[model samples]
Target: MRIVILCGGESSERDVSLASGGAVARALLERGHEVVLVDPAAETPVLAGPLHFGDVVDEFAVGKEPPSGLGRRLLQERMEGALTAGPVLGLLRDADLVFLALHGGWGEDGRLQERLREEGIRFTGADSTACTAAWHKGRGQAALGAAGLPVAERAQWQPGIEGVPQAVRLLLAAGPVVTKPVADGSSVSVHRVDSLAELERVAAETGSGGVELLVEPYLPGREFTVAVVGDRALPVVEIELSSPLFDYTAKYQTEGVSEVCPARIPADFASRLQELALRAHEALGFGAHAYSRTDFRCDAAGEPMCLEVNALPGLTATSLLPLAASGAGWTYGELIERIVDLAMS
Candidate 1:
C-alpha cells in the first residue's frame, strides 16, 4: 500500500500529531508498506503547516528539530510547500490512500474528509458530517444521549447576549462543573472549578480565545477510556493520573500517567463500557473506516458514566490506540498495518 499520512495541523494538538505520524510512519514501514509521511510542515506545491481547517496554523517546522543539516533543509523546504492552497483533495490526487493522523480543526472535525469526498479520495473514519458531529463535544454528547446511551450530565456555553445566563444555567444543572473549550481535545483549558468564583475567574481569563466552553458534572470514580476500532471494542485502557484529575501535562510530556488494560474492572462492567463505546461510535454514523475512543467514569459500584468520545484518538506510539492494541495482542506495526488495510478497503 502506498500510504501518505497527513500529519501536523493548525490545532493545539499539532505537536502530538507529529509524534503520532512518526509512529505511524515507522509502523507502516516495518510492515513493508511504501509509506510517505507528510507533515503539513513538509508539503511542497502544497500547504503543509498548521491549517485550522484552513484558518490557523500550528507550524510543524521540519528544520526546527534535531537532525542532519541536509535532512533538515530538505524537510524544511518540503514542509514549506504544503500550505499552497488549491485543496488537500487536489494535493492527494496521486495517493492511493490517506491515513489521517491529524487532530482538531478541519482535519479531525471532518472538514478535510468532506473535501476529500468531493474529490473522491479514499480515507479512514466516518463521513465528513459524522466527523463534524463527533468533533463537536457538546453536540456529540447530545447525540449519544439521544441514542439511549448512559452518559454523565453536562452543559455547553452557547455565545450571545445570554452567554452568562446560559453558562449559569449549565452550572446550576451540573456541578461542581468541569469546564473547558468545547471543541478542544486532550483536555486543554480543562479545569475542575468547584466554586463559582473560580469559574468566573477562568471564564474571564480564558474568554479571549473565543471558543465556547462546556461545563460537565465532575463524576467521582475511576477514569477509564474504552478504545473502539472498526466495529469492535479493542480493550479498556484505564487512565491513572498522578493528579486527582487528568490534565494536559498528564496527557503528553509528563510521565505522570499510566494506563491499565483489561482494566482490572469486573468483566460485566468492562463489557458494558465496550458496548457503550461501540454504540456511541455507531450513533455518530461512523463506518468500518472510522475509529473512536469512548471514555467513561466507573463509580465504586462499577456503573459506567459515559464521557464524550474522541473520534480522532491520538496515533502516536504511546497513544491510547496503540496502547490498547498492545494489550489486544496486536503489535504496534501489526495494528498500523491493520488500520491502513481498513483505511482503503
Candidate 2:
C-alpha cells in the first residue's frame, strides 16, 4: 500500500505532528508499505521517497516550544491557499490512504478532513463531522456528559463578550480553575489558576480575538488517558507531572512528566475508565474512527472525569497512545498496520 502521511499543519502542534508523521511513516515502511511524507502547510510532498525515520525524527526531536510566530505564518499561508490543493492533496489522491498524524486546529478540527473528503481521499482517524465535534471542548463535553459519561463542569468564553469576564470571574471565585483554548490539543495554553487574578491574567494572555476559551474547575488528581482503536481500548496510561499543570512543555519537551502504561490502578477502575472512554468516543460519533484517545483526571473519590477526546491522537514515540499500545502488546509497526487496516476496512 502507498500511504501519504499528512502532517505538520500551522496549528500549535506542528512540531509534535512532524514527529508523529515521521514515526508513522517509518512504522508503515517497516511493515513493507510505501510511505510519502508531506506538510500541507508547505504545499509540497517530500518527493524524494521515504527518508530514514530516525533522520526525520531527529529534525523535530528537540523539546523546545513551537513558536507562535511560526503558527501565525503557517496559518497565513494556509488561509491564502485554503482551497488550493496544489501537490500535497494531489499526492494523497493517488495513495491507498493518508495517515493523519497532524493534531490541533486545522489538522484535527475537521477543516483538513473536509478537504480530503471533497477530494475523495481516504484518511485514518475520525471523519470530518466527528473531528469537528471532538475538537470543540464545550460541545464535546456536553455531548459526552449527556450520554451519561462523567465530565467536569465547564464554561466557554469569548474574549470580548459583554458578560463573559464576569461569568468567568464567577467560575474562578468558586475554586481553582483550568483555562485552555476551547479547540486545541497537546495541552497548549492549559493552566490551573487558584485565584481570580491568575485567571484574569491567563484570560488576557491566552485570549485572542479569534480563539475562544474553555474554563473548568481544576480537578486535582491523577491523570490517565485511554486509547481506543476500533471499539477496543488498548490500555490506560497514567500521566504524572511534577509541575502543577501538564502543559505543552511537559508533553513535547520531555520535562517534568512521566507516563506509566497499564496504569497502576485497580482492575475494575481501569475497566471503568476504558468503558467510559469508549462511551465518550461513541457519543462523539468517533466509533468508526481508526482510533481516538480520551483524557481523564480522577476526582477526590477516584471517579474518572472526562477531559476531552483526541480524534487524531499523537503517535510520536513518547506519546501516550503508543505507550498504551505497547502495554497492550502491539509494536509500533503493528499498531500502525492495525490503524491502516481499520481505516481501509
Candidate 3:
C-alpha cells in the first residue's frame, strides 16, 4: 500500500505528532508498505525533510528532545497558525490511505477530516462528524451524559460571554476545578484551581488566548485511560505523575510520570472502565474502528468520571495508546497495520 502519513500540523502537539508519524512510517515500511511522511505546516510539504523514519527515532533515542521554556514558546508560536493543505492533498492522490498521525488542534478538530472527505480520500481514525463531536468537549460531554454515561459537571466559556468569571467561580465553589480549552487535546492549558483567586487567574490567562474554555470540578482520584479501537477497549493504563497535572510534558517527555499498563485494579472495575469507554465512543458518534483514548477519574465512590476522549490519540513511543496496545499483546507494528487495515477495509 502507498500511504501518506500526515503529521506535524500547527498544533501544540506538533512535536509528538511528528514522532508518531516517524514511528508509523518506519513500521509500515518494515511491513513492506510504501510510506510518505508529510507535515502540513511545512512550506514545501512534499519535501519538508528526508523521510528518515528510523533515523528520526535514532535522534530521539540520542536525546534530541522537545523544546523547553523560551524555545518551547517559540515553536508553539510557529505552530499556532492554520495548516496549508495543497501539497499534502497532492501527495494523498497517489496514496492508498492517509494515516492521521496528527494530534490536537485542527488535525483532530474535524477540519482536515472534512477536507479529506471532500477530496474522497480514505484515512484512518474517525469521520469528520465524529471528530467534530468529540473535539468539542461540551458537545461530547452532553452526548455522553444523555446516554446515561457518568460525566463530570462542566461549564463552557464563550467569547463575549458575560459573567464568565462568575460562572467559573460557582463551579470552583463546589471544589477544586479543572479548566482547559474546549477543543484542545494532550491536556494543553489544563489547570487545576482550588481557590477563587486561582480560578480568577486561570480564567484570565486562558481567556487571553481567545479560545473557548471549559471548567469542571476537579475529580479527585486515580487517573486512568482506556484506548478503544473497533468498539473494544485495550487494557486500561493508570497515569501517575509527580507534577500537579499531567500536562503535555508528562505525556510526551515521560518525565516525572509513571504509567501502569493493565492497571492493577479489580477485574470488574477494569471491565466497567472498558464498557464506559466504548459507550462514550459511540455516544460521541464515533464509528467502527475509530481509534481513540478516553480518560477517567475514579471518584471516592469508585465510579469512573469521563474526563474527555481523544479522537486522535497520540501514537508516540511514549503515548498511552501504544502502551495500552502493548498490554493487549499487539506489537507497535501490528497496531499500525491493524489501523491501516481497518481504514482500507
Off by over 4 Å in 3: 47-86, 159-161
TM-score of each: 0.84, 0.93, 0.89
Compared to the true structure, candidate 2 yields what TM-score? 0.93
Output the lDDT of residue 27, model 3: 83
Error of 3 at 178 (Å): 0.9
Task: Give model 1's TM-score versus the native structure.
Answer: 0.84
Best by TM-score: 2
lDDT of 2 by residue, 44-106 (tens): 546236543343333456256754753467564863373365556567788889888888877
lDDT of 1 by residue, 1-345 (tens): 666778766566666777777666666665656655566654442333222121222233322222212344454444334534444434576677887887766567877787778777787766787888878888888999899987766776644323466646566555566777788777666787877778777777554446687777776678989888788798888998787677666777447788788688778877878888899888988877778888887554757777778877887655788888888998988877777776767
> What are the RMSDs of all candidates, in order?
7.1, 2.3, 3.5
Whichever of 1 and 3 has more TM-score, that candidate is 3
Which candidate, 1 or 3, would have the higher lDDT against the true structure? 3
Total clashes for model 2: 0
lDDT per model, in order? Answer: 0.70, 0.81, 0.78
